[model samples]
Target chain A: MEKVTININGADYSAEVEPRLLLVHFIRENANLTGTHVGCDTTSCGACTILLDGKPVKSCTMFAVQANGKHLTTVEGLAQNGKLSPVQEGFHEKHGLQCGFCTPGMMLTSVAFLKKNPNPTEGEIRWAISGNLCRCTGYVNIVEAVKYAAEKMKESNQ
Target chain B: MIPAQFEYAAPVSIPDALALLRSNPDAKILSGGQSLIPLIKFRLAQPALLVDINNIGGLDYIRAQDGWLKIGALVREADLEDSALVRRSYPLLYDTTLSVADPLVRNRATLAGNLAHADPANDHPATMLAYRAEVVATGVNISRVIPIDDFFRGLFATSLAPDELLTEVRVPMPKPRSGGAYLKMERKVGDFATAGVAVQLNLDAAGKIEQIGIGLTNVGLQALRAKRSEDALRGALPDAKGIERAARLAQEDCDPASDLRGSVEYKRNLVRVLTMRAIEKAIERAKGM
Candidate 1:
């Protein structure tokens, strides 16, 4: 076992996890932050998306040990105390989900993506979230949700 | 799913990474973890340790120096997507890499990791073959260069020594007016290649085919340079008749394997179709250059 200290969602966390333990397992089990969902063991599905050093990545595909001492932002840490993030509000307003299984990963992944390429078009937005699959929304509404979030983010920045 | 128990260490420098690999020859080098982590979940690979090279600096760059395109081994596909050198000089590599998995996977996966894994279905091997790239590897106290074709041994196998790591990929610039492109068929956006073709076109002063090199993938145990196709293309017109004949020769050169992608015969047909498409695109690219 390797003892690792990771800063996830602005919190410094220390744990003694097996070397093979995935970042998703570490977040969900060790830190007890289960907002990040694990849908596919393979890297094919991106339901376990999170921000590693401010970039979106599949947490399940990364070893917990690999994330040692890195800044990670998950869906659970998106909002301020007693306030929902704009991305969270976008999903609710757009009816962007039905199963909600892929919601947390989808929202968090989009947060980092928009930050990198802000004011993206519909086509770019679709391509950005291509890794995070949504079976329920069929992606029509999810794409709109991202656009909505972009507008909100732009407003907040102004 | 959790991988089997193993020791993991991420070294901060080349010397530190080398020491870790030297101590654990049975361990695996974790790059993007896109491919390695999946294999671990399936229990297909059970390495005793994982030598993480993510933090090791000075291994992620692509520059043109001394008449060669020098690409550091740790350069990610995302880096390639944004590389001005690749876009300006080697659009074939850019095109081939853009078709890899998806944007998210490309952001994390390294170019060296893909080539080093030596997957038969990978799209980049054939491009490297046509470009005549060389793999530079560093061992304990020695560094050596291996030709692309010789570096890949078989399916999911490579000639890379356990203690050695790929350091650089150098693609020698072609003569003036030479161009290349990779064309492939996939069932879905991120699906493995059904059959792919990478073709290099070189024109003489008179705009005729001075030389040609064709490399094919998903047609055999590993990617094969289509020597027959290249031979047929040399000294021919860079026009309709020449491309048609070369496309036919490209089909004759292939020995495809049957799988979920297609039957051997279907792959042969695809080789003909894609070879024609790639040759045309390559000619256009080369002409512009």
Candidate 2:
């Protein structure tokens, strides 16, 4: 096993891993961050979304060793002081989930989306979340949730 | 999904990367890990080592020098979309990159990796053929410049020797009056192209077509240059009539195969529609820019 050091959610984390271990597996098994889910080995779905060096990437598509020495922000680390992040709050307020299997990835994706485009239009919101699939809400509430997060993020700066 | 075990080396320079790839037989060059990881998980590839080139310094920039655009091998799709050079000088690449999968994939997927992977359904090969780009590759004492047409030889294959790594792509700047566009038909957001078309037109001072380059993808074992379409559009303005004729020629030049993603007839028809749309958009964009 190769020992690699990584920073997750502002905390330094280390683990001994086989070169074959996927980043999602490392986050879940080694770091004990189970909030990120894996839907497919192919990166077609956004179920394993996480921030690697502040950019959202499908954790299932990346190796743990590839992320060594990089900053990782997973779904479990989204809140601050036990309060929900704006994306989480927005998702909760808008009821953007049903089975909740895809929420963590959705929130992480939303966090990255809002940073790139704080005021995404309806079309942009739909396009931004196209990578993330939701069989439950038909994406109506998810779009609203992203809008809510954007609005809340903007208001917080004032 | 755990990939088979391999040695990992992240080299920060081209020479170091080359050395790493040289020392390890069956070591794969990993740029973005988009295509490689799935191959690893499925056990299609059991590389003994993975030499990651993402950290290769000075290889992530797109620069214009001597009338040719030089895109480093590490330049990510997101970097292409966000790059002012590509957006302003090569809008077709920018538009096509933006249309690939989505933002997250673009953020990690590199242009070199896309071309090196050489999947027939990949959208970039068509655009590269349209641009007449030269693919540069390096291996042990081997450096070659391969034209886009010769780069891809078959389905999911390229001319790149196993020891060679694609280093940079050199694209000549189009003439001042030239314009280009790329269009693709995909079944889903993340699926490969059912068929794609990339059209480039260079107009004379009188707004008549001086030269035309057309490329089609997913209609063959490899992306094809629509020689018939180019022959039809030569010395003609890509007006409605010319575009219509070129679209037919585009379809005539392709031999798409039926697969799970699309039928042969549907893919051939997409070659027509996407070819027409791409040519029209290229002409309109040319007039404006």
Candidate 3:
């Protein structure tokens, strides 16, 4: 076992874990933050998405030891205190989900993507979330949710 | 799913990483962990130790130096996709970077890792084959530059020794009036190519082909350079007839297996069509039109 300290959503979690522990398992099982889902363990599905060191990555495809000293942000970190983040509010306002299994990953991907492109066309939004697969809603409302979040983010920054 | 038990070492220096590999020949060097981790999860690879090289510094770089573009082993695919310099100067490389798995995977997949994996379906091998790139392999107290032609030995195999780590990739600067492009046909986003073609060519002042390189991907045991196609085009202007013949040779050169992607005939014909289109696009870019 290797001792590792990882900062997730502004809190540091330390543990002694097996060297083969996947980062998604570390987040869900060890840290008790179950928002990050493990839909496809093969890295094909983006259900395990998270921000590692301010960049998005598939946590299921990385070893927990590989993230030993990195800063991570899971879906649970999207809101501040009790308020929903713009992306979260956009999802609620736009009815962007049905089963919600792919929601956390979708919101996290959108939050990070908006940081790079504040105003994205529908095509760009569709492309940005291409990794996150949603079996429900057929992705039409998800694109709307991203567009809604983009507007909200731009308005607040003004 | 959890990977099988293994020992992990985070090496902060190249020498330390090399030393770890030298001592544990059964160990695997984990750079980015985009491809290796998946294999580990599926139990396809069960190395006893994993040498995590992310802790090492001074490897993440993509810069032009001494008339060549040098890409360090640690540079992620996203870095190339976001680089304005790459977009402005090397459209061929930029195209390949965009076609890699997806935006999220590109954030962690390294160019060196992609090449070192040596999967025929991987994108960069054909791009490097077209560019005639060279890789720097560093072992304990020994480093050698190997041409891309001699890099891949077989499927999932490379010429790199167990103690060696691919540290850098160097692509020669393209000559003036030159352009290149890569075209791939995949089932969907992030899927491996059914058949892909990478073409890089330079034109003389008379608009005659001065030099050319063609690489075929996923239609062979390894990325194969279309030497017959290239030889037929040198010093000749690219008319429709010449381009058609070159494309036909590329179709004949490849040996693709019949699989779910396509039958051998379908793949060969796809190669011919993509080759013609890529050459035309490359020629258009070469004229700067």
Candidate 4:
């Protein structure tokens, strides 16, 4: 076993982890943050998406040992001071989810996407979330949710 | 899914990493871990030791120097996608980088790892073949340059030795009146190429094809340089007849096996059509249209 310290959502979670332990497992089990879901476990599905040093990456495919000393932002980091983040509010207001299994990953990807491209066209929005799959809502409402978040974030200068 | 247990080491320098690799033949170098970790999780690759190289600095770079575009091993696919130099000057490379898996995967996938993985269906090999690129492989106290032609040995194999690490990739700068394009067809987003073609060419002042390169992806044992097609187009006028002849030659040279993606015949036909379209698009870009 190896000792690793990963900064998740601004809190340092230090633990003794085996080399085979995946980052998704670390976040869910060790840190007790179940917000990041593991859908496919393979790289194809983006359900375990999180921000590593400000870049969105799938956590299931990466070992926790590889993330030592790295800064990660999981879905638990979306809101500020118990208030729902713009993306969370957008999803709720826009009815962006049905099953909601893909909600956390989708919101994390959208948060990172909007930070980069504040004002995205509909085509760009679709392309941005192409990595994160949503079996419910047919992705129409999810697209609307991202648009809503983008507008809100722009207004708040976030 | 959890991967098989292994020992890990994060080396802070190239010499230290090379020493670890030399001492541990069963070690696997981990860069972005986008590809390697998947293999590990599936138990397809169970290395005894993983040499995590992310701690090493000065390797993640994409710069144009000495008339060649240099790409460090740590340069992620997203870096290429975000580079204005790549977008404005290297259209072929730009298209290939953007064609890789997806934005999320591309964020952590390195170009060097893609070529080193040597998967025929991966997008960058065809573009590297078209560019006639070379890779710098470094061992303990020694380094050698291997042209892209000699890089891929077979299916999921490369010329890199167990103790040597691929450090940099070098592509010749595009000359004036030269342009290129990579055309890929996939069943869906984030899927490997069903069939792909990369075409790079230069036009003389008289509008004749000065020199050309064509590469075929996922239609052979490895990425293939269409030498016969390239020979056919060299010094020829950029016209329908010449382009058709070249495309036919490329089709004849590839050897694809039938699978879920498509029949062998369909892939060969796709290659022909994409080759023609790519050459036309390349010519148009070369003329600044």
Candidate 1 local Cα displacement, residue B214, angstroms = 2.3
Question: Model 1, B143: alpha-carbon shift in Å?
Answer: 0.3
Model 4 spans with C-alpha error above 4 angstroms: none
The 10 consecutive residues of candidate 3 chain A with the worst lDDT sum are: A38-47
Q: With candidate 2 superimposed using the best TM-score fit, by how many Å does residue B91's alpha carbon deviate from the native?
A: 2.1
**Model 1 off-target regions past 4 Å?**
none
DockQ of 4: 0.89
lDDT of 4 by residue, B41-136 (tens): 999999999999889999999999999999999999999999999999999999999899988999999999999999999889999999999999
Give the CA lDDT, 0 to 100, for residue B203 in model 3.
99
Compared with the true structure, the alpha-carbon lDDT of candidate 3 equals: 0.93
Q: How do all the candidates rank in terms of lDDT, highest first?
A: 3, 4, 2, 1
Error of 2 at A156 (Å): 1.2
**Candidate 3's residue-wise lDDT over B185-240, tens digit each?**
99988889999999988999999999988888999989999999999999998999
Choose the strongest candidate by DockQ: 4
True contacts kept of each: 0.70, 0.80, 0.78, 0.93
- TM-scores of all predicted structures: 0.95, 0.97, 0.99, 0.99
Per-residue CA lDDT of model 2 for A1-158, tens digit only, reads 88899899998889888888898988888888899998866887789999998888899888888889999998888989999999999999999899998889888888988998998999998887788877688898998888999999999988
The TM-score obtained by model 3 is 0.99
Better of 1 and 4 by lDDT: 4
DockQ of each: 0.70, 0.78, 0.84, 0.89
Model 4, global lDDT: 0.93
Query: Which ten contiguous residues of candidate 1 chain A have the minimum total lDDT?
Result: A128-137
